[model samples]
Target: MSKGRLLDGVSPIEGISPTDSLDTLFLKSGSSTAHSPQSLRAKPWPARPQQLCKGIRGWRWWDSALDVVVVMLPIPFFVLAAAVIFVNGKIVDQEQFTILNHSIKGATTLFPICFAAITGRAAIKFATWKLEQGTTIGVLEQLMGSRTVASALTTQVQLRSFNVIGLLMIFVWSLSPLGAQSILHILYTPVLPTSTASSVAYMNSRQQSYSDPRPSSSFPGQWFNSLAIEMGSMLIAPTEVKISSMDINGNVKIPCQSSLLASGTPDSEGWVQTALMNATSNGSLVWSSLFGIPIELGTKLGNTTFSIESTYIELSCNNKTVESLEPDGQNGPRINFTYVSVAGPYFSAEDPDPLDPWIIGYRGVDITTYNDTDGSAYVFPLFCPDCLSSNFANKTIEAGTIAFQEFEGLDNANATTVFCNPYQRYVESEVSCMKTAATQQCQVTAQRDSVLPHMPPEITYLSFPLVALGLSALLPNVTPIHDATNEVQNYLVYDPLDPLTIMGEDNSVLTSGGSTPKFLSDVALSDIETRLGQILNAFVYGSTWNASIFLLGESIDNLQGHEFGGKNASFVPATRADIVAMIQNQTAAFTVPAVLRTQAQVYVCNFAWLGVFLFSTVVMLIGAITGVVFSRKTIVPDYLGYVSSLAKESPWIRMPDVGVNMDGMDKARLVKEVKVRLGDVSYVYGGYSEIGRLAFARLEETTKVKKGKLYV
Candidate 1:
């Protein structure tokens, strides 16, 4: 190889072309001297790069300033909006609202990150300048030096798409409705003071009740017995009784006073005693004989026993009113009484009638069989008539029967005294009886130490009519009285397992395999029954006459009156208007205003416009970041080719085959040769390689330089 032609068939260009020397040729012809290479070297590069649009003033500064303005436009507006929201307390701590607010705030930081990404092109430019020792941009500037500015202009136009996209993203981030709505909400739709109101949940059908006083152990037990004393006297000398009275509306008033004598007769005790004797008899002959034999053997313990109780029930009127004597006809009533006792198969402390009035209370009676008996007979089981009869007992009483006698002055007075009216003034007595076949062996005698003087006891009956009266009084003209009774019920359920289950002590369990059973034993059931019976008895037997008089006619609306102790049965001292007023006040206690009725209330933190503004601002920032990361071009490393060492040793000029045609060269062979010669030579300066810049720059340089040769 020749020193000047180290590569075969390659040589350097001889000299510069006359056309490129036109500027110097003209200058030398005019000034009589040509510029030396030293003078050219000393001159500065042109202020603007050689490009198609270099003469176009204001492009670079205008473009850059517009981009910066758009990116920064939303900053102040965003700050103002956030400050208003925070200061006005519209920035809620609630997660639902704050999620949107956080997104808006996050978008504010995206601007700087996205701007840095877009400016990666500047980093590329700086790195290329250090490597290539050039002031202008890489390939385009080199081409612009020799070609018309249009070629450089074309290359620059390629980047306009990315720039336009970035600008659009910035514009959206700054001027979107997010900020506008925030501003509008702060200005026009500010927060307002919230009002609180309430509503009512009516108890449509409810009840009120009162229980009675009773003995502690209302249920029958071995020692469950109560004693009550009744001993008082009263005299009413009114000439004539007031049988009934009514208010202005014709509603009856109770407790009319009367003065008429109905005293206990000499035979009253004897009659009561006879009834008690009959009631106490057991129908079994063996039992009767056994009882009589024991009493006869022991010598008549005593004639009989007597227990008498009396009390004066008083009723005085606030306003003095006329009083009257009881009539001497069927209309006038006298004292009445009854007695009952039960004998189970065996002597067990269990009441047959749990609701019986005498179970937990005292009723006056002249008991003929007061003495305890030791029968020598074998008592057959009760509730078995056949067994007793077969055993010569003749008859059996399943449950004990009652014997009663009611005597009124009118019935046996020969047209001289009052009548028998169980509902009004009457005298009554009773004793339990049993009949058996014993030839009257068992005998009993009874006597009364004293008797009652009955002259129609003073009675004060009260009729509440609470439900209908309340409704009719409040809505006198509108709402009609309804039988709201069935709509509601006073339900009390005994849940034995509730407490156990709540405490997690319940034995019952359901598992994947099976269920475990837990139940109350018989003893538990019996104990429960006993307790329940006691409670019920207290509620029943301990109740007072006054309570019944006031509560019995709760829903009644009619004004007609019934007799009670020669007076109205259902009545109240207060007028109907007053009763109605009481009901109104009671109903008012359960009501409240309509607006303040929610279990929990949640108030809006601020206006709706502010939320909209926040959401829109977040969307714009995301868009800008998306464009920066995915759309804009940043630098990378690759190259078209490298200079061959053989070619660099000599001056060379040759054109490689373009893809359009390989000219006579084998395409694969040529490609291999180019790779072998150029693969080791990289565009990147040590440890720094930008594949995108090098590849693009090398292609442009190769096309312009043509076989890697210089013209001058």
Candidate 2:
């Protein structure tokens, strides 16, 4: 035997005794084999027939490598998934930012807790030399015990794998279609620059379509734009045919300044100015592509902000455009080629022409050149409305595109105007060919200025004064305007009070206060009297008191002739002759004494109260009688409202009935046989009902005379 590894092989434990060894063998048998010494064998004998495939084969495949991996890979994932469920349960999003805040907290807390628990278990087991029982520690301690430190790299190696696997799964999730959608929302958020703090931002589908200066060149020289909706896609080409250096139709080689508009006398729509103002009170918003756009002051107010976008002169000119106004002859006809930055006396520091803000920056004619006509793309403009208002004379209004190809001739009267943008367009003169450069295409750019001005549309949320407006919608504006002269009077100067008047000392009160006038001028009074009678024309209508209890159901009885009476069910019977005398003879009816009415009320009230007393007394007596008859359980509050459907066995308490005999012999009988005997048991009945509580007790003491054999 190897002396160095005695306990590792067959050596007995240092603490084990001879008898304890035998006890172990007996316990291993599990048969409770504490029989005689001869019966306790080293191994038990058994015969089995009912079962085959004795041990489960799956347990045989479990090995060290399998255990290590299980402790690592799948265990981590399973643990992670379970942690996710706990994480979901813990997220308390009662506010807007809680979702993001809790997510970070959850990740931080979960990792530390799992690591500490797992490490602590390993440490405790190693110190004690233990599994659940006996002396055997876990594998983690074996790895952590390494002295070289490099040997402890198992911890690092294992954790690195976990991170790599987690990262792989994250990448897979991001590539999914659902992940792409989440990314887009964070990137492109909508907001309206001109609305209040409570407002939202949106460019209508129509306006968005017009926003793109260059769309596909399919519809040549076709300009589509609208004031309310987006700038729709359009294809700009020359209006008249001119076969110069290149082909006219299929692929034309034209100069960059080719006119898309025509020329004649400048029409107002052609040459006009426009100013657009967009602002928001608070909250920083991006209009996607525009960065650092100028924010104006006049339109902004205190908390509000405004943004400006500028673009100028986007059309070719013909000799029909006229002479250059600028000193430089290098400039085109009129002020065309002169990229005028901005005229002075136009804007200032304190209030930049509430309409225009940006100081135009025109680096001469650094034009937007297009090499391929079909290569049009929609790039968002880097400009704000305030800046652009100063640069461009007017709006580059455009319209319909592919998305709106089918919706034409939409009506605004009945159909929802929100979804449609159709134009009833008009102009002062015919569109000039100079604006289009005679390119045989519908280059319907405004004729006068390259862009013409348009008045800002009304910024009303709803029309027709929003159904009802101002204080009248929810409350009356109490503007107490008392009239000096009353035109409409309710009272005549010397008239007597009506017999029905409830106010003391009153002529009908005049409407001389508040908005009602006190004096009636003869001219208006004559008109009123001619329309009315010379006398008053009363506007008669019934008024309701909402004391409907007086008019409906049994409540009508509540109002039964209680003039001043204090009685219940009391009234003097008046004969038909008496009623007849009273009605036809008003003098006698008026003479009826008030004392008689008081007497009627007194009688009725006394009778009603007596009835109530009688009813309450009867109910109390009934409740007392029932309470004494049932068990103590009946008196208890627990069973007051609850009743069992099952019947309980009846209890029998003896009562003494006087016995009578037919002959000389008197006899006694037991009405109930005694079953359960208890001394503290009690019974109750009538006043003697308390004796039912002692009914069984009185039985033994009762004296009874019996006829005995030969008794003297």
Candidate 3:
């Protein structure tokens, strides 16, 4: 073959025979100054045919497009992920959130590898193109073609001079980790509390009817008898049992508002009496017309909070020994009870024509007997009258003249006379109700101290009847004077001052017969006051039963219509249907606005981290596009940085040179059968050999190095 130029501006080494093989020339010029590794010159060979130079170029416009598409593939995935997080700020389902997160994570991991492949290929093309332009294999050139992040970083630091391509290569490789972390951290699911607007049904007492009219002569015979029987059952039931029953039947808890009476006083009972008196005088009592309405039930909200208006009666009393007494011999030795039988201020003012006998007043006698002997015994009678009122304000009452003229036993008598003033109050309160996990609870948060305006007439009318029923059912009856039978016969009466009589004996208070009994002198004043307060509480608590019964509207007609003789009979009590119709005719179903809160897993997007990811993505896309544009004209196989590619045309190993301009894939297919290895490939001169150099060469020419052997 004739000697010719293998590269531009290069010739074979001087005095070298043109007929010698290229390897012989390489070994011969190893010691020469012009052909050293640091300043190597391309070897001469036979000139290539013009047709070979015109063979198909490795890269095409379509190849560049493919590279750009690979780099841009992950962008849509990122956008989709961001949109999902932004659209649904909260994710309630765990599986969907996890699946979305995993998809993003997989994309995040895949993008960097794809980016490196495309850019790394472009980098190899750029380096080869520079060599084709006759540029030397310098540090910047080597760094621009580096594929790994560590090498890229090292190359970046070693760059003492500014080169746009080198800096861009470093920048591109740096984004791998940054973009990955950004994508990984961009979305996270956190458990957070969220609320939605909801509504709940609540008892709206303000909307109930406040009117019930009956003639004075028909008061005891009409609705009063049924109310008394119902009150009787209520009085017999324990307070705790009543409360528990309310909870079970209503699906709601009605907490008592006894705290309204908790004014730090030695005698809370006496304090209540005084307060009630003051309230009645000043007309400051708070009243609710529909006092016994049940709260609406069955709300299916997750966790709700709302406020409602409610009312309950509170009772207080004062019990003390009478310091002075005057007697009148009407029938027998007894104390007479007296009070004006008129509805309170609220009722009288609001009623168009107030019923005359709606309010109850006592005009009866209580007799006491000591030692069962006429001369030696002392009489100390106590009487408690039904002083029911429609008014929630303060009021006072006084006892009538006692029939006993004198005390027979004087200072030595063991019995003592006692007086009691029981006070009832109408409490308007703001109750807060919360329903969580299908259970509802209510508590009285505040009470109205001053009277509210526009008291419902139904509340006033029902208040008198309720108080009267409570008093009669729970308290011992007082004996009235009979004109025909002037003889006053006392029956066994349970003393209200005795706790044992109230709590220990089931039949003591509920079944006790006629006249109010005398309080024993041995009973403490505190015990007397406590027992009176308890009786009053039992009276007020009857409203809870009324509420429950009213909730059982129309059903009671079936249960009690025949029991009351007949529904339409004049002697029959007002039916549950009548009361329900009277109250609910004009009212809308009560409801209140509430906030329903529930815990959910929320997809929170960290835009700052997302911005970093997008920044890296945009930079990488620009870099990839730039690479494609800059390497469009390259005309060499993708042979950079590959040991197999390096083995071709190596001085120690001979191979055909026809594939230099072919694509790497085509070249790889052609050389798939060629075997190569990293081994000893030392040059021998004048029968002397130096340290072996490790290089990839043909299997026939190379010797596999031992495991422990070292080579240059």
Candidate 4:
């Protein structure tokens, strides 16, 4: 309250003093600074709640730009990576339809997105903290001017924790060689092609796939049915990720390729007509898997998440090379480093640059040693940077140990036939593992139409949740509450009056209230609403979004003269549905939900309903009680008291509580008052001492002051 600057290191905290001038004192920023009225920044975009969240102009624009780029850039970048890789081996004379490339491309789209997500998330957090720090300091300045700097510094320091954590997460993910190695290894790992159909139809797995060059073979309606059910389940009920795969199995004997027709076997009504209807008239196709991984299975019909989906599965990868075929099986490879280049730099046996990041040495697979005669083993930069001679030397001989069925540019018949046999060819297998992972592990074999009737179709439950939620509405007896309670207890009936309340809780309330049935008791839902919402999301939103999309491409092909085709005209060859029904008539799909809740909803929803009243009522009371209790018991008074106490002290004297002494006061000693009395002795400003002699000496030339205080 005094007009003059307050005392130093004095009140509120004993033995500790504020600097007589703010520049000399130290104060903590952050929650402590909220007491100051001036430090807080006013809201921006007062009209929109979201915009209002962006308190600073600089921060707002940057966030918007970050979000936009994060959302948009990955799509094009993914396209570019695909375009580059897709035509790598295909673009010689013309291009061939290799759908696998597209799938590989699609999966890869998420790689960049992951990076964008990390960058966006980190930038957003940092910006938020910076903006908040400013706002906090501003508010503190409003309450007490001298403490502003200390408060600002404190808040900024506190918030840096978030950025540190975020950076650590990014660093861990990016730098983790193991994760990258696993993924890259997977990319290079060989994949073998299996018949998409079934092996049983082959009569044996030891032969080449039997192809069905059928013009009449077509899949049928159960696809649409499955599409509808799975989608319905997704839309109505909740869902989750049960990473699984179906292992289908069966056999078929087709008379000829033209007879292959594994279409619409289950009929619109859903039936499994086994025992090939006509081997001569129409060959049956029994499509199924053996060692398949079911990502998703089962179907959700109408209101209930009445889906019998999959056996719970956890991800398991087989990284170990099968010993039976591993190169080491014969005799763990021994690298023979016979001096290939005697004259090159580092002429010693160990070539410094020769595959510094060495390649794995194998026995019978593709092998390339130094081609001494051709000098093909010369060392060079892995990624060519030179304009000319970028492929300075032949670093790798692509045809190491591979034995191709046909050879185009080779003189020796045996050399071209085998992948590579640097040493004399022994009894080792000719071909290297089929160069791809996912393709290798999973074997798909096309079945005979007579084997069952059609290919077993896959079911996507995108619409399951909608059906669950909507049908839940329809079941006057099965509102959301009823169904949930019924699931819990058979005897429990849903009370329509209070739809939110379960029958059990309502009964408890009724009995307790002595017939004046309480509106709702046992109303406590869960603080873990986000978790459950996430669960619901897994069941609901995720199911809807990620569900194996039911592409009911309708053309004049089948069912009611509709053009069952794709979005543009891209063709979809198989409909796994018809094949599924052919396998089992009563085999209803197992539907599961996949959804998760986010942090934002929790903040907004509660704020939307509670409004200021939430804090105005309970929060303030709790805060007041806490402040009173804490202030009395703790060292250094609580926030409210600090505010009130600071109000009485003059501004220019106090400083933040950080361990810095700027005010030139004995920080360890408390002071009762501060005064700048010109005692004809020297006066101190910052660290400078100005006496009669010193003042006269320094300001001899200037007369900016009107015989009193210096103006500048």
lDDT of each: 0.24, 0.20, 0.41, 0.23
The TM-score obtained by model 1 is 0.20
Model 1 regions more than 4 Å off: 1-333, 336-602, 605-611, 630-632, 636-712
TM-score of each: 0.20, 0.16, 0.48, 0.16
TM-score, structure 4 vs. true? 0.16
lDDT of 4 by residue, 23-52 (tens): 333222111333332221121212322212
Put the candidates in TM-score order, highest first: 3, 1, 4, 2
Candidate 4 has an lDDT of 0.23
**Model 3 agreement with the true structure over 1-712: per-residue lDDT tens digits:** 2222222222222222336554564555343433223211133322352232312354456665676686676567557556665645664566776777677778787868866776676677667667666776664355453687777767656655447756766777888877877787777777777776665554323232211222333323443344344433333334342333132233232223343344323232232221333433442322221113344434453555544443333222233233322232543222212221123211111211111101122212111221233422112311111112224223322221111111112122221333443333333334445556666555333444324332321222123332333233222221122221100111112342232333333221122345332323445544434433433332333223223234333222233223221121111222334323322332222345555666766777888887888787776666566556655665554556655466554654444454445555555555566666677644322111334456565554457776665556
Ranking by lDDT: 3, 1, 4, 2
Query: Candidate 2 lDDT (Cα, whole model)?
Result: 0.20
User: What's the lDDT for residue 75 in model 1?
Assistant: 57
Give the lDDT of residue 64 in candidate 3: 55
Which candidate leads the pack in TM-score? Answer: 3
Best-matching candidate per lDDT: 3
Model 3 misplacement above 4 A: 1-68, 76-92, 104-112, 118-145, 154-199, 210-303, 309-440, 444-588, 591-593, 598-712
Query: What lDDT tens digits, residue by residue, belong to model 1 across residues 549-629?
Result: 212322221212532112122222233343233232222111212221112223233546656555554554443343233
Report the C-alpha lDDT of model 2 over 1-712, residue by residue, as the tens digit.
2212222222222222234333343343332443222321222222232222212232223322433432352243233233333433221324522543354344334433333333322332232222222432224233233212232344435444334423332332222222222222221112222222211010000010111212342111222111101100001112112112111221111111112131123334343211011111211111111001111111212222111111111111111111213322433211211221222111111111111101111111101111234423212332111112222323333321100000011111110001111121112111111111233211111222212232121110110111101101111101111232111122111111121111112111122224322211212322222211111101000000111111121222333454311112112233334323322221111111111000110101122322332232222222222222221112111111111100011122221212211101111112223232322112111111112121122222222222341111
Model 2, 283: alpha-carbon shift in Å? Answer: 27
Model 3: which ten-residue window has the lowest total lDDT?
A: 484-493
